[model samples]
Target: MNKITYGRQTISQDDIDEVVKALKSAAITQGEYVPAFENALKEYTGAKYAVAVSSGTAALHTVYAALGLKENDEIITCPNTFAATSNAALYLNAKPKFADINEENFLIDENKINKLITENTKIITPVHYAGLPCNMEEINRTAKSCNIKIVEDACHALGSSYNGSKIGNCIYSDGAVFSFHPVKHITTAEGGAVLTNDEEIYKKCLLFRSHGMEKVNFKHMPDSPTYHEMQFLGYNYRMTDIQAALGISQLKKIESFVKRRLEIADIYYNAFKGSSKIKMQKRYKDRLNSHHLFSVVFESNDLRDKVYYYLKENNIFTQIHYMPVNKHPYYENLGYNYKDTPLAYDFYRRELSLPVYPLLTDDEVYFVIEKINTVLKAL
Candidate 1:
C-alpha cells in the first residue's frame, strides 16, 4: 500500500555494524577493507583479479585505458545501455559504434558486430542489459577472430551467469565491470569494480585508479621509499574503506538477493504470460539473469506510458531502464543518431521497469501485477 520503487538497496544491521567498524578504523581510504572487498568480489565472481573503484564509470574508464583504447580507436557496443558504457570509451578519446539489440532479449546481436569492426576497432563492450547476460561466448569468438578485446559492461549483471560461469569471471572477456550503487543487486553506497584475469591489465587498473602513481614500479626512482611515479594520466577513483566494508557485507547476501529477485520476476512473468498487451523479456536456458529490473514491454508506446502514469498514481514508482544512449542531447550533438538502432528506440518506447527489489514484499508484488493488469483492461 505504500510507495514501491522499481529498485532499491536492502541494508541489514550486519552491514551497519561493518560500516561502524570501518569508520572507527585508522585508515578509511587506501586501506585494508579495499583489498578485502576486492578479494570478496574475486571469490564471488571467480575472477583472478579485482580492482575496486569509486563508481561503475570509473571501472569502465580504467579498463578501457588498460586495454589501450586511445584517440580515434573504436569500440562497438549496443545503444540500449546507460551512457557510461560508451562514455567510458569516449573518455579515452575513442569512438563508440553501436550495434542494435535483438528484439527478443534486449541484448546486442552478436551477428551484427562484424559490420561495425574497423581497422581501429579496439574493444567490444557487451552490456548485459537489465541483468540478463549477453551472449558473451559468441561475442568472445567474434572478438578473437577480429583480434579485438572484450570488456563486459556488466553493471547490470553482478550476479548473472552465462554458460554456467558467473558473469564477472572474465572467462569470455578481457575484463568485466560491476556496479555497487544502491539500486544494484549489491550496494557499497557508491562503488564498482573491474574483474580481470590478466595481471598486466590488473596492474594497469590499479595504477589508473589512483592517479597513475605507483610506489613500487617507479621508473625514475626505485631506491627511495617516498618516491612514486605518475606513469600516465589517471583519475582519483579510489573506493573508501567504509564503502568497501559495506560492500563486503552486502556481497555475502548476494545469493539470497538474486534468488528473491528471480522469484519476483517469475511471478511477474506468469501473471503477464497470457496478456496480449504486455510482454516479458525472453529467458535463455544458457544464461541466468540477476533480475536487476523486471521490465515489461507493452504492445505500444502509448500503452506503456499510460501504465507508467497509472502505476505512479497508485503509489508504484516504476522507471524506464534507459532511453537509447545515442539519442541523448549530448550524443546527438556529437552526430550519434538514435534511428540507427531502430530496435533500441522501439524498446525504449515500450519498456517500463517494475518493482523487483529483494525488499519488495510478495503482497506488493501482486499489487503491482494487479494494477498493471487493471490498467490494461481499462484501456
Candidate 2:
C-alpha cells in the first residue's frame, strides 16, 4: 500500500525541462524567466500586474510594506486561516483584529467585519480557504463603505473564478496573493505572487521585493544609465529564475490541473453528500472552486480523530486544514486565545483535510471514500 498524503505536486517532464533550460542560462537569479512568469500570472489572472516573490509570506510582507501598514493601523481578517494572512500586518507592528467565520462555508463573515472596524482600520485581508472564495461582493461593499483596502489571501485559489471573474483579477479587492507550494493548485517549489490592477501598488510591490532598489531609467540624464538608487529600506524577497521557469511551465497546464482537482473533489462531494455524520465545504453556483483542499467536518472531534488515525494506520495520511490562527501559541502569548474567536474554535475542532491533489489515483480516491464511510458507519 502506497502512502497517500493530503496533497502533492504533479510535476511533468516539461516542468523539469524548463528548470534545466533556466539553469543552463547565464542569469539564473534575475533573468528573463522571472518576468515571463509574472507576465503569465498577470495574463492568467486578468490582473494588470503581477510580482513574483520568494514565498507566500514574502508576497504578503511585500504588499503590507508597500501599503505602508504601520503601528496605529489595524487589519481585519478571519482567524480561520494561515497565520501569515494576519502576521503580515503584525510584521509592521500593526494590529491584526480577528473577525469570526461564517458557519456554513468556514469563510470570513463579511457581516462580522463591520463590528471590528475602527477609525484606525487600514485594510481587510480575506483568506480564500480551501480554494473556496469568500463572499467578495459583500466584503467589497463593506470595505468600500469604510474606505478600507482589500488584500485577498488567495494562497489556495489559482485557477478559480468568482462571479464569472478570475480570482486574482482584483475585481473586488485592491490586490490578491497566491502561493505555489507543493500542495497548492500549482508548484514553483517555493514561490508566490501578488496581483493587482493598480499600477502604483504594483510598482510599490516590485520595489519592496528587491531591496527597495530601482534601476534609474532616467531619460533626463542619458549620461548616467548605470546609476541606481535605493528608494527605501526593503528586503531580498525576489524569486529566482529557476523557480520562475518551473512556474511558467506549470502555469501552462493550470486549467487542466485544476480540472483534475475538481474531478477528484466531485467524487468526495457525491460520496459524502446527505450524510448525517459528515459535512463538506458548501459550493456556490456563482463560482468554481480550485479544490486545493477537500476538507470534511466530522460531527465531533472524537470521530474526526478516530477516522484520521484510522486512515493513517491504513497508509492513508491526512492533515488538518488549520487550527485557528488566534489559538496558536505565539498569538496566545500576545493575549489571543480560543476565546477570542468562537466560530474558528468550533470549526477547527471538526475539520480534517483528506487527500486532494491533481495526481491522486482513482483507486486511492475510492479507497479513501470507502474507509471514511466505513468509519462513519462504525461511529
Candidate 3:
C-alpha cells in the first residue's frame, strides 16, 4: 500500500529544469537569481522590499533583530501556533507573553491583546494560523495606540488576502514573514522571506541576514575593487541562489496552487457540514484562507485520537497543527503552564489536521472522507 502523506510538495519537470539550469550557472549560492527572486516576491506581495533567508525561523529572527528587541523589551503573541512564533522573541532575550486565541478560528484575539500589554511591551507578533488572516485592522489600531511594533507571522498565508489586500502587503502590520517549506503553498526546499514597506526595516533585515556587513562602493576605478564593512552583530542566514531559482519557478504557479487547496477545503467542509462528530473552522467571508492545513475539531480529545489512529491504521497520515506553546516543557519550565492560556489548550486538545495539498487527487479525497465517516459511525 502506498503511504498517503499528510502534506507534501508538488514538483513538476519545470521545477527540476530550473534547478539544473541554476546549477549549471556560475553562481549557485549568492548570485543574481537571489535578488531576482526577492524582487519577484516584493512585487507579488505589493511590499516595497523582500529579504530571503534560510528558513522561516531565520526570517522571524531577522525581523526581531531589525526591531532591536532586547532583554528589557517584551513581546506578545498567541500560544496556539508553532513554537518558532514565540521562540524568535526569546532569541533576542525579550520576554514572550501569551495572548489567548479566539476559539472560533484559533487566531490571536484582538480584544485580549491590550490587557496583556504593559510598559515593557515593545512588539506584537500575530500568527495567521492555518493561512487565515488575523483581524489586522483591529490589531493595527491596538498596536498604534500602545506604540508597539507589529510583526505578522504569516508563514502559512502566501497568496492569501484580507479585505482585498494581500497578507504580506504591510498595510496593517509593519512587516510580515513567509515560509517556502516543502509543505507550504509553494516550496524552495527550505526557504523564507521577510516582506516590509519600511526602508529602514529592509536595510536592517538585509544586514542581519548577511553578517552585518554591507559592500562599500568607490566612484574611482581601483585596480581591484572588493570592499566591505561590518556594521553590527548578525548571522549567516542568507538564502542560496539554487533555492531562489526553485522559488522563482514555484512562485509562478502559486495562484493555481492556492486555488486547488481552497477547492479541497471546500469539499471537506461540505462533507462534514452538520455533523455533531466534527466542526470545521469558520472562514470569514471578507478573508480568503489559503488553506495551508485543513484541520477539523472533534467534539472531544478522545474522539480526535480515535479518528487519528483509525486513519493511521488504514495507511492514511494525519497530524495536529500544534499543541499549545505553553504546554511545551521549555515553556513550562519557565512558569508557562496550561493555566496560563486556557483557550489555547482547549483548542489544541480537539485539533486534527487532514490531508489537503495541490497534488491530492479527488479519489484520495473521497477515500479520506469515507474513512472519516466510517470512524464517526462506529463511534
Candidate 4:
C-alpha cells in the first residue's frame, strides 16, 4: 500500500526554472526577484508595504519588535496555536499572556480578550487558527478601547477574508504576518513576510530584517561619505533570492491553490457532515477561509487518539495542529498555568488535523473519511 502523507508541497517545473534563473543571476541574494515578490504580495493582500523574511518566526519577531514591546509590557494571544506564536513575545522579554479561544470557532474570542486586558498589555496577537478569520470587528473595537496594538498572526490565512476585506490589509490591526512553509497555502521552500500600512512599522521591519544597515548615498550622508552604518541591532532575517524567485512563481498560483483547497474542504465537510464522532470547526458566514487545514474535534481525547493511530496503521498520515502553549514545559515555567485558558485547553484536547492540500485527491479524501468512520465504529 502506498503511504499517504498528510501535507506536501505541490511544486511545478516553473517554480524550479525561476529558482534556477535566480541561481544563475549576478545578484542572487539581492536581486529583482525579492522586490518583485514584495510587490506581488503587497498587491495581493492590499497592503501598502511588506517586508519578506526568512521564516514565519522571524516575521513574528520582526513585527513584535516593530511594535516596541519591552520588559513589563505584555502580549496576549490564544493558547490553541504553535509555540512560535507565543515565543515571539518571549523573545522580547515581554510577558506572553494566554487568552482562551471560543470552542465553536477555535479562535481567540473577543469577549474573552476584553476580560484578559491589563494596563501592561501592549499587543494582541491573534492567530487565524485553521485559516478561519477571527471576529476582527469585535477584536478591533476591543483593542482600540484598551489602546493596545494589534498584530495579526495570519500564518494559516494568507488567502482568507473577513467582512469583505483581505486578512493582511491592516485595517483592523497595526500589522499582519504570513508564512510560506511547504504545507502552507503557498510555499517559498521556507519563508514568511510582514505586512503593515504604518510607515514607521514598515520601515522598522525592513531595517530589522537586514541587520539594521542603512546604506547611505554619499549625497544623503554628510558625516560619513564612504560607508553604511548599523543604526540599530537587527537579525539576518532577509529571504534569499532563490526563495524569492520561487515565491514569485508560487504567488501567481495562489488563487488557484486556494480554490482547489476550498473544493477539497467542501468534499471533506460534506463527508463529515452530521458525523457523530467529531465536529467541524465553525466558519463565519461573512468570512472566506483558505482552508489551510481541515481540522475536526473528536468527541473525546481517547477517541481522537484511537482515530489517529488507526489512520496511521492504515498507511494514512494525520496530525494534531497544536497542544495548548500554556501546557508546554517552557511556558509552564514562565508562570503560565492551564487554568489561565480553560476553553483553549478544552479545545486542544480534542482537535486533530487530517490531510488537506491542493493535491489531495477525491479518492484519498474518501479513503480518509471511510477509514475514520471505520475506526470510530470500532471504538
Candidate 5:
C-alpha cells in the first residue's frame, strides 16, 4: 500500500476545470470569481458577509484589525492552537493572554476566561481546536459582560456546528474565520475567509483585505472613478480569482467531505474504545465536529513518541497537531510561560493526529487502526 498522510486535499476533476476557467478569465487577481466565492461561503455558512483572503493568517489579521485591536490591547485565546491564533495579535502589537484548555474536549476552557480578563482585554479569540467548538455560549456571555469583542479562530471548524447553527454563522462572535488550505476541509490551494453578520465589521474587513482602501466612502474626492482612499493601514491579503474558483468548486463537496471525516472518526473511536492506553477527545451533545483532525492522547509522552515513529516506520505518517504556542522559543522570548496553562502543555506532549482526510479510503483507515493497535499493544 502507498504511504498515508495525516490529512490532504481531495481534488476532483470539477475543481481542476473551475481553476482552468478562472485562469482563462481576463482578471485573475480582482475578478467576479472572488465575490462569487465569498457569496458561496456566505450561503454555506449563513454569514451575512464574507471576505476572502490569501490565507488563514490573513483572515485573522484582517478581522482583528477591523475589530479595532490595537497596540497593548489584550486578546484572550487558547494556547493549544497553531501559532497564527496568537501571532495575529502580535502582528497588531496587541498582547495575547492565553486561557487553558478543557482536557476533555481540547477546547478553550471558558471557565478560565474571566480570570484572565483585565482592563486591557479588548477581544476574546476562541480557537475551535481540532474542529470542536468551544463552549461559545458561555464564552460569549463572559465577553459580553466585559464588553469585549468575540472573534472565533475557526480555521479548524468549517463544517462544525454549535447549538444547531453552523460554525461560521457568527452567532456567537463578531466574526469567524475559516482556512482553505489544502489539508483543510476544502482547498483553495492557500486561502481563507472571514464571516461576519455585522455590516461595519464586514466593510472594514473588506478594506483590510486589500490595503485598507475604499472607493465608496471617500474622504477626499466624491465621484472620481480614478480616486480611492487609503483609510487605514492594511496588507495585500486578497485571494486570487483562481484560488476563489477552486474554493467555489470545493465548497460544493464540503458536506460529503465532512461526512467521510466523521465516518473515519467513528471507525477510530470504535477501534480504540477498548484500549487502556488511548484517550479520545470528548464530544459534546450541542457541538458537531468537522473532524479536520482525529487526535488521540496516549497514556504517556514516551508511548506517544514510540507510536509516532512506529507508524512512520510502517509508511504511515502521523502528525503532532501543535506544541503549546507559549512553549515556542519566540513566545518564550516574550516572557510567555507554557506552564501558565498546564493542561495545554500536557496536551502537547501526548497528542498525535492520525489520517482523517476525505480521500483516505476505508481500507487505509482500517490499516492505520490495525497498525496503531498493534504497536500500542506491543508497547
Candidate 6:
C-alpha cells in the first residue's frame, strides 16, 4: 500500500505562477505585493489591520510583545495546542499558565479559565483547536470581569466561525493570529499574520515584526526626512513578497478548501458514528468548522496506541493532535505536575488525528476508513 499523509498542502499552477511573477518584479520583499496580501487577508477575515510575518511563532511572539507582557506577568492558555501558542509568552520571560480544555471540542474550558485567573494574569489566549471555535462568548464575559486582554491563537482556524462571526474579527479579543504553514487550511509556504481592530495593538505588532523600525516616514522625527528609527526592541520577522504572493493566491481558494475538508469530515463522522471503540468530537451546529483536523477519541489509552501503530504499519499516517503542553519535559521541569489539569491530561492520552485534508481523494478516504475498521475488528 502507498503511504497516505495525515495533512498536506494543496498547491497549484496558480500558486507557482504568482511566485514567478513576484520573482521577476523589481521589488520582491518590499514590494506592493506585501500590502496587497495583507489587504486580501483583512478583506477575507474582516479585520481592520493585518501584519504578515515570517512564521506562526513570529506572529505569536509579536502579539505577546504588543500586549506588553513583562517578566512574571502571566498569560493563560489551553494545553491542547502546539507549543508556539504558549511559548510565545515564555519567549518574553513571562509565564504561560495552563487552563484545562473541554473534552468535547478540545478547546479551553471557559469555567476552568475563570478559576485560573489571578492578579498576574495579563492576557487570555484561547486556541480554536482542530478548527473548532472556543467558548468565545463565555471567555469574553470572563475576561471582561477580570479586565484581561484577549489574543486568539487561531492557527488551526482560518475559515471557522463562532456565533455567526468570523474567527479573526477580533470582536471578542484584542488580536487574532493565523498560521499559513503547509498543513494549514491555506499555505504561504511558511508565514503567519496578526489581525486586530485596535490601532495601538496593530501598530505595535507591525513595528515589532520588523526590528521595531518604522519604515514609513513620520513628520515628527527630527533627525532626517527619510531616515528610519529603531524605537523598540524587535526581531527580523517580516514575511517576504514571495510568501505574500503565494498567500494571496491561496486566500482566493480558502472557501473551496474549507468546503472540501468539511465534506471529508462528514464521511469520517458517518463511518465511525456507531463504533464501540471510537467516539467523534462534538461540533455545534451554529458554527462552521474549517475542518483542519478530524480527530477521534478511543475507548482507552491502550486502544489508541494499538490503533495508531496498526495504521502506521499499514502505511496510513496517523498522529496525536497534541500531548498536553504541561506534561512535556520542559514544562514538567517548571514544576508543572500532571495532576493539575486532570481532564486535559486524560484527553491527551487517547486522542488521535486521522487523515483529513483538501487534497485527500475519495478513494483514499475509503481506504483509510476500511483500514481503520479492519484494525478495530482484529482488536
> What TM-score would candidate 3 get against the native?
0.97
The better candidate by lDDT, 1 or 2, is 1
Give the TM-score of each candidate. Answer: 0.99, 0.97, 0.97, 0.97, 0.98, 0.97
lDDT of each: 0.93, 0.91, 0.91, 0.89, 0.93, 0.90
Q: Please list all clashing residue pairs in model 5, or write none if there are none.
A: none
Instruction: Kindly list the per-residue Cα lDDT of model 6 for residues 289-329, writing each as its tens digit.
Output: 88788888999999889888888888988889898888899
| Model 2 C-alpha lDDT per residue in residues 103-130, reported as the tens digit of each score | 7888898889999999999999998999
Candidate 4 or 5, higher TM-score?
5
Candidate with best lDDT: 1
> lDDT tens string, model 3, 1-379?
4677678999999999999999999999989889999999998899999999999999999999998898979999999889998898889989899999888888988889999999999999999998999999999999999899999999999988999988999999888999999999989999999999999999999999999987754344446657666778999999999999999999999999999998999899999999987988888989999989897899999989988998999899999988988899999998887677898888888899999899998888888899889988987
- Model 5 TM-score? 0.98
Candidate 1 structure quality by residue, lDDT tens digits, 1-379: 9989999999989999999999999999888999999999999999999999999999999999999999999999999898999999999999999999998898899989999999999999999999999888789999999899999999999899999989999999999999999999999988999999999999999999999988785567566678878888988999999999999999999999999999999999889897889888899998999999888899999999999999999999999978999999999999999999999999999999999999999999999989988888897
How large is the C-alpha RMSD of every model relative to the true structure? 0.8, 1.5, 2.0, 1.7, 0.9, 1.4
lDDT of 1: 0.93
Error of 3 at 167 (Å): 0.9
Model 2 CA lDDT for position 70: 88
Clashing residue pairs, backbone N/CA/C < 3 A, model 3:
none
RMSD of 5: 0.9
**Clashing residue pairs found in predicted model 2:** none
Clashing pairs in 6: none
> Clashes in candidate 3: how many?
0
What is candidate 2's CA lDDT for residue 305? Answer: 93
